[model samples]
Each structure stands twice: as structure tokens, then as C-alpha cells.
Target: MKAGTNLEKILESGKFAVTAEAGPPKGTSAAVIQRKAEMLRHCCDAVNITDNQTAIVRMSSLAGCVIARQAGVEPVMQMVVRDRNRLALQADILGAIALGVGNFLCLSGDHQKFGNHPQAKGVFDIDSIQLIQMMKQMRDEKKFLNGDEISGDVPMYIGAAANPFADPFEYRVKRLAKKVKAGVDFIQTQAVYDVPRFARYMKMACDMGLDKKVHVLAGVIPIRSLGMARYMRDYVSGVTVPDEIITRLEKAEKAKEEGVKIILDIIEQLKEIPGVHGIHIMAVGWEDIVQEMVEKAGLMPRPVL
Candidate 1:
């Protein structure tokens, strides 16, 4: 049992795991994180604290994890390659472990051009796969990236992201295979609005036996309005919002209710997919809806691991 985190245990115990995202506030208030943690504590097995998601600076994910842990919710802290070099990355990994953060989601973060500080330079010293390999080495081999010996256990459950809806669809599964080979313990994919395309990606992954190698959690975002749906369809890279869904939203009197129904339906379909181990709800700023979504999707009463 790697890391022995509640998330890892829930997956290992063969129960369908549910995870949700909680982005830290732009300011330095720990109270905001505590409130978000309280909201998500019972709705999911673990909560993901994002690391400067979209390249926008926020309270550190490590600090957010510590706050979430204090608030009685397990946190999966995100580590992005765009902001820190290997040395800094290693330092933070050690710090996070010492602070009792047991789960990690490695990412090659969005470009700085997309964030609030567009002029900021990105520090992509290592990509996500290298970060995964480095963490695996630290945890399993008790050694640093340069082959230095580690003095203590670096226990962690490592995770990475996948985008089945990305271009050159055939390469998507192959990329996932690479991450699995690089020692990713779990994966949370890009928001899945086009279920058939994602299903095909999963089918290809299952055919290659990748599912046995790592846990795959389908990502879902509940759209709140027609504008949100269109934006996701047109602007969000690696996310495909189907035209039918857009039309449905356009015709609906209550777009929010329709959006909830769409996610509930997606959850049902995701549960039947052979390779999917669970779902990761990523309702970025609209965290208040997560509990209701989980309950409506029948994912409540998360396992006591």
C-alpha cells in the first residue's frame, strides 16, 4: 500500500473512489481553505488542492494541504513543473511529507501567458513525467534524482493527469501508457463532456492493459450556463463539450439543473466503463455544488478507509 492515504486505500479496496478539487484563495487566508475543506470532507474520499492552476498564483498547494488536513479532510496536493525547478521541487516534496501530505498530483502546468501574471517566466525545469519518475525514485529507492541517498521514508501516492480529448487522439492513450511506465499511481483525466471519445480512449487503454497498472479517474465539470458550455467547447484546451449538450443547455429554462443532470448521467456512464476506477469532480470555483452533485450521483457515504 503506497502512502497508505485514504485515497489509495479506497482504490485498493475495490470501492469506486470519488475525489474533488479545491483551489486555494488568491490571498493568504487559511480560513478560506478551512471552509472549502469542511465543505468537501464528507463528499469525497480526498480533496485535491491545486497548485497555481491556470498559472495564476495562489496560496501554495502545500500550505493548502496542511490547512485541509487540520480541517479533517485528506488532501492530494498538486505539484506543477511550470513554477519550480528540480531542487525546489524536491525541497517541497520533503516539506510536504514532513507536513503529513501523503498524496500528490504532478502536472506540467498551464503556460504563464494564460494567467494573471502573463509577463512571468515559467520554470519548466522538468516535465510532469520526470517529476513522477523523480518522486517514485525518492519514495521507492530512497534516493534523490542525482542518486544521493535519502535518510528517511518519502511515502507518497503519486498521480498525474491525462487528456483523452486532446489532439491526435491516438497519442492520448500512448501518453497515458508512458506515465504509467514512469510510475504514476493514479490519473485524473481532462473534463470529459464527450463520453464516446473518452470511452474509446479508455478502451484503447484497457486493451493495452494500462488499467491494471494505474487507477484512472474520469474528470467531470458541471456547467452552470450556456456561456460556460460554449466557453468550454471553444476555449478550453483538451476538453470537448459536445454540440448536443450545448443545444440542450441553450434550450433549457434552468441551465444549472440541466447541467447537474448531465453530470449525473455522465457519472452513471463512467461507472460502467471497464478501465475507469473512479470519478474526479472538478467544479473549480463552484465548490458548493460538489456535495449536492455527489449525493445526486449516489456517491455519498464515502468509504471509511
Candidate 2:
């Protein structure tokens, strides 16, 4: 049942798992993806191939996974419910697994208004929770949504996203529990800039013992520059960038190294938390710095998967 994914094997061996994310190019260039994956190789246990994140069009996540795999990086394929109907979603799942993708992260996706196509209609055919359950059925029961048996096997490691800093913050842990009950094997949360808030969220999850049942990987995005920090603070919701971080970014002579240091400090503290199983570094367009950050955090040359 282990999907033969390095990530699954790393976590199964009880090592602190590290993962990164990469967006496939908007054009048909798998080479671009392969190059990025090569940069992240040996930097983390696996790389998450993002689906048209922010609703901007790009190569499919399935194709991105193929490129990453060919580059020798394990991938967690992201699936969003915003554009695909039930049939398309299931079809992609089948197709992705057939093409050797073994891990997935189910998402409700950002609304289309945020991307290039503001006029595109949204598809909420099924929410993310339902998608999680559907995949669980396919993998565990070896059946599709219509209850038809799969020809050979349905092997997948399912994950869900959570935002601890989002509104109704008091209920974030409960929402995570819902995902766990619905069959999430692992979870990757939104960016963590507030140590107190993240600790609170982990405390709650630990209280319920959800941490023991599922892997919880905290998300961290290195602040590339003072402007980037300000941009995220002003535009991104559910993300908290402390004024201290902003001040540090503003004062640093070398912004990128300072950013890496800040994130390294965070990773050091995050690893000590009881429930946090790993770190998922979202390098965004700054993929070049991921391995350095991981290395500084003492997670370098990643554990074998």
C-alpha cells in the first residue's frame, strides 16, 4: 500500500520529511519543469507539482509530475476542484496514477477572479472534502465514484491543505480533523509566520491526537526581498508576516540570505514542536534558494525515500 513514493517511505521511517513546490511553465515546456526539479533534487523528499495555481493557465499537474519524475524527484500532484467536474477529476486521477504519480493534494482552488481569466465561471461541482472521500474510495475500495471496480489497483497517498491563520481561526484544527476523518494521509498548511498561532494550532491537533494519525507539514515561504514581504502582507489573505520580519528584511544588507536565515530559524523552532512532522518550503519563483534554506536548516541532502 505504500505508493513507493519517497515521501511516504521517509515519513514511514519516522524521519522529518521536507517537500517543495514548483509551478509548471505556462507554455508547453517540460524541460523547464525538469530543470526546476533538478534544482530541488536531494533538497527535499518530494516536490509538489502545483496545478494552475492562482487560476492562471499552465501545463497540467499530471504532466508536471511526469517531468519531475523523469528528473528524479518524487512529486505530490496537486488537484483542484475549480475547473474539473466529477468525471474529469476522476479521469485525471486514473490517468495520473497510470502515468506513475502516487501522491496528491486535494484543493478547493483559488477563485478564477484572482487569475488572468477573471470572467471564467467557477466549478464547485464537488468541494475538496468530497474529493478527498472520493479518492479514498478509489484507493481503498478499488472502485470509482460509480462503484465500478478498477482493473488492477488504486494506489494513492492522499493529502489536504489547511490554513491555520485563516478566519474562524479557532476552528482550523476542527476543519483539519474533518479532513483526517474523511481520509487524509497527510496535511500541508498555509504559510506559518506566526509562531504562537502555529503552536496553538498544533497544540489543538495534538490534543485530539490527529497529529499521531496523520503527518502535519508546516508551510514556510522565504521572503525574497522587502518588496516581496510587503506584497504578501498587503495582498495574500490568511498569511501573517510579522513586522519584525519586515524590519529584518528592510535592514538586511543581503536580503535573500537574511530571508533564508529567518526561515531557517523558523524551521529550527518548528521541528521541536511535538506534532509538526516536517516542513514544506514554498519557494515560489525563488526555487533557486530552496536547497540552501534546507541545508541551513540541517535538512540537507534529504533522507532517502
Candidate 3:
């Protein structure tokens, strides 16, 4: 069992794994992270503690992971290349491992221009693909990116993000292929609102046998209101919310309930796709809704492996 994390165990055991996102608070309040972690504890195998997501500075993901562990939930620590150089990245990986963080998600973070600190310069020392390769080497060979030997085991269940809903659709699969080749053990894609398009992406991935090489978890975000839906459809990069969803929410008496129904329907449809190993719910600020969504989707009673 690679890393022996609950996420890896659930996926390796062939169960439809469920993972969720938990954004850290901007301040030093551990209570906020603890509350979010408690809310998500039983709903998902693990929660992703985001690292300065959207280029907005926040509590460190490593600290959040430790707090989430205190809340009795496993955490998938997210590391972005935008904020740190290779030395910092490698050092943080070692630090997180020493703190018992076994799972990681590598990402090229959002641009600093969009964040609270617009003047901040991005380090982008290495992109997400190289980060994956580096983590894999650290885990499998006990070696650093510079090929120096490590004294002890660096066991990590490496993961990376994918955007199947992104433009130039044909290239999405190829990009995922590169990550798999880079030795990522799992993938969590961009939020999926256009099911047909996502299915096509999966078909292409399956044709290349990418599913067999790595666990692919289709991402879904629960739409809360018409404004949110429209914003995601028009503004969010790589996310494609369908017009039908917007129309439904537009006319619904209770948009929130309708939104929940939409997410459940997407879950049902995603389960039917061939290469999908699981679902990753990104509720954004609505972390409290994850338990209900997971339960209503019949993904509850998370495996004991």
C-alpha cells in the first residue's frame, strides 16, 4: 500500500473514493480549520488543505493539516509551485512527512496578480509536473530532486490536479498522461459541470489506459445560487457550468436545494463513466454541506481500510 493513506487505501481497494476541499482561514485561527475539518471528517476519506488558493494568502496548509489531524480527519496537503522555490518545496515535503502527512497534491497555483498581494512575485521554480516527479523520487528512491540520497523513508501518496473541462479539450488527456508518466498516484480534476464533455474526456483517457495507471477523481462543486452558477460559468477558468443548471437554479423556489440535487445527479452520472475512480467535491466556502451531499449520494459509511 503506497503511503498507507486512507485515500490511497480506498482507491487501491477499488472503492469509489470521496475527497473534499477545505480552505484555510486567512488569520491564525485554528478553530476555523478545526470546525471545517470536523464537518468533513466522516464525509470524505481525506480533506485537501489548500495552500494559498487563488493566490490569496492564508494559514499554511501544513499547519491546517496538523489541525485537521487533531480534529480526527486525514488531510491531503496541497503544495503549489507559485510561492516557493525547489529548496522550500523539498523542505516542506520533508517537514510535512515528519508531521505524519502522507498524502499530497501538487499544483501550479493561481497567479499572484489575482490575490490580496498583487505586488507579490511568483517563484514558479518548478511546475506541478516536476513537483510530482520530485515527490515520486522522494518516496520511491529516498532521493531528493538533486539525486542526493536520503537517510530515511519518504513515503508519500503523490497526487496532482487536472482540468479536463479546460479549453483545447484534446490536450487535457495528454496533459494527464504526462502527470501519470511523471509518477502521480492519483488525480483530482477541475470542477465538472458539463457532464457530456467530461465523459468524452474520460473516454479518451481510458483509451490511453490512463485509468489503469493512476486513480482519477472527477471534481464537482455544488452550486449555491444563480449568481454563483453564472460566475463559475463565465469567470472561472477551466470550469464549465451548463446553461441547463443555470436555468434550473434561475427558476427554482429553493436554489440551494436544487443545487444539491444537481450535484447528486452529477455524482450518479459520474459513477457510470468508465475511467472515473471516484469523486472530489469542492464545496468552496460551503464545507458544511459536504456531509449531506455525500450521504444523499450514497457514499456514506466510508470504508474502514
Candidate 4:
């Protein structure tokens, strides 16, 4: 198959596009990573390789993306500027593009204090917005951050993160609008459990004109157990699980089955939302469940554009 950036095509097609994330292991072994990527390749438009996800050390995102690409899977190279300066970020982008990873997700990343390396320093060298601006400069102006002209520009399908369920939910939409104004091609939101609230937020986005300007991929993370549900409720910021879901999970005879059913319900409702561009399923370790959700939701294969 001819390699192409499905993310760009997804945006242009004006239809929903599905994407999923795969976190590379901490060690050098690519066996688990490759297996997961291959499993999700046919189910999603592209697979995102998380970079040092949650500030925990992991295989390099670029290397993982390259391995996925070699396996006939389109890769989204995640670039977290939280630990690197502008120079390092720029260099990694160029290298990834050369290695055939055309999609990029810009993140500020989690604070190091939350990770195992509590003593390690955090570098917010540039906030996510600034990083997006820098990427625009490199792509549109063909100039380095130091003002030197580059031989060529890097082509990337730019993506950014959003949390619609964050506290003071109204403010999250406003922030997302700012990201869209800052030239974000797409917005993959934080995990969503409250469809009603998410629907309202989608309306807000449409009202702000963001719906027309940028694609929005609703994030979904399946809750495997009651512990997982509670962790999200109490610990994970920007994720809201209703009492109804908790009740269902608590009463379930089989936790995984209940979790998958809940995700299917979420996806079904999301498919009816007008401004929803697609779903980005974050299965975490349950990557295998993605196909079941996609199949259950009746999301067809990537429609030719």
C-alpha cells in the first residue's frame, strides 16, 4: 500500500476519522509495541505513539512511530516539549518527518513530580501554544527558531489536546478555541464519560466557529474495573464519570464486559453528534478492545476521499 498521511486526508474529507494511541514500553524491546500497532492499524486512521507518557520513561516516540510505520501502520509522532528546549524539539520534528511520520501531536506533558523521577527537573521551555507557533513557523516560513532559513519546510498534520470535562468546563472550550486560532489542525480531547456534557460542549464549539475550522476527535478510555473508574473520578483531572456508570460497573458480574459495553454506548451517542469529527480511543493496556468498540459502533473503514 502507498504510504500517506491519513490525518490530513481525514480533515479534508469532512467525515469522522478514527485514531488510537499506543504507548511504547520502557525498554528497547519493540515486540509488544509492534504487535499492538498492527492490531490497531486496520481499526484506526493512524496510531499515535505517546512520548514518555505521563512523564514515565518509555521508548522514544519517534522510534516507536518509525517501527509502526515500517509495519504498514500510519504513525502520529507525539512531540512533548515539556522536557526539551526549542532546539531539541525542532530537531526531533525534522528527524521524524524524514523518517516518514507526518502527523504530530504537540503536548506540554505531565509534571515530572508526578512521575517516578520526582527529583528530575521539568522544562516547560515552551508551552503547547508556543510549540504550535514554532511548528507553524518552521512549516509556513521555512525558518529556524534562530531566524536562519531552512532548506525546506516540514509538512505535518498538526494536532493538539483538549479537556472538555475539565473543571469550569466553560473555560476549556474557550481554551480549545484559542488552540484552533493558533493553527491546530485537529483537537483530540481528554477522555469523555459524560456524553450530555460533551454534546453541550460540541454545541459551544460550533457556536464559536471552531467546529468548522478544526476537526475534533472525542477521546474515549474504557474503564476496565471499578478501581479504574474510581481512579478516573478522584485522580484524573478533566475526566468525569457519572454515578450511573459507576453503579453499572459496581454491579457488573464481569468488569471488562461491562466496560466494553459502556464504551460502545458512548461511541454510539458520539456518532450522532454533529460537530464530532471522530473518536480517539485510549484503551491503555486494553488496546485489543478497540476493534470491538469500532465494530460495535459500526464505524466503517476509512472512506476514500
Give the alpha-carbon lDDT of every model: 0.94, 0.90, 0.93, 0.86
Residue runs of model 1 more than 4 Å from their true location after superposition: none
Q: Tens digit of lDDT per residue, candidate 3, span 1-305? A: 77999999999999999999999999999999999988999989999999999999999999999999889899999999999999999999999989999999999999999899999989999999999999999889999999999778898999999998877888989999999999999999999888999999999999999989999999989888889999998898878888899999989999999999999999999999998999999989999899999999999989898
Ranking by lDDT: 1, 3, 2, 4
Measured on C-alpha atoms, candidate 3 has an lDDT of 0.93
Select the stronger candidate by lDDT from 3 and 4: 3
Flag the better candidate by TM-score, 2 or 4: 2
lDDT of 2 by residue, 1-305 (tens): 54767788887778999999999999998898988998899798889999989999999999999999999988999999999999999999999999999999999999999998989988889999999999999998989889989777878999889999998988899999999999998899998988888999999999999988899999999888888889988899889888998999888999877888888888999999898989998989989898888888888777654
Candidate 2 runs further than 4 Å off: none
Error of 2 at 198 (Å): 0.3
* Count: clashes, candidate 3: 0
Off by over 4 Å in 4: 1-4
> Which candidate model has the greater lDDT, 1 or 2?
1
Which residue pairs come into collision in candidate 2? none
Q: Estimate each model's TM-score.
A: 0.99, 0.98, 0.99, 0.96
lDDT of 4 by residue, 1-305 (tens): 11247877876677788999999998999887889987898888888899998889999999999999988788888888778999899999889988988888999898887777888878888899888778777877888877888786578788899888877877978988888877788888888899999999999999988888888999999888989998999888668999899999989999879988998889888888978989998989899888878878888665655
Which pairs of residues clash in candidate 3, taking residues 3 or more apart in a chain or in different chains? none
Clashing residue pairs in candidate 1 (N, C-alpha, C atoms within 3 angstroms): none
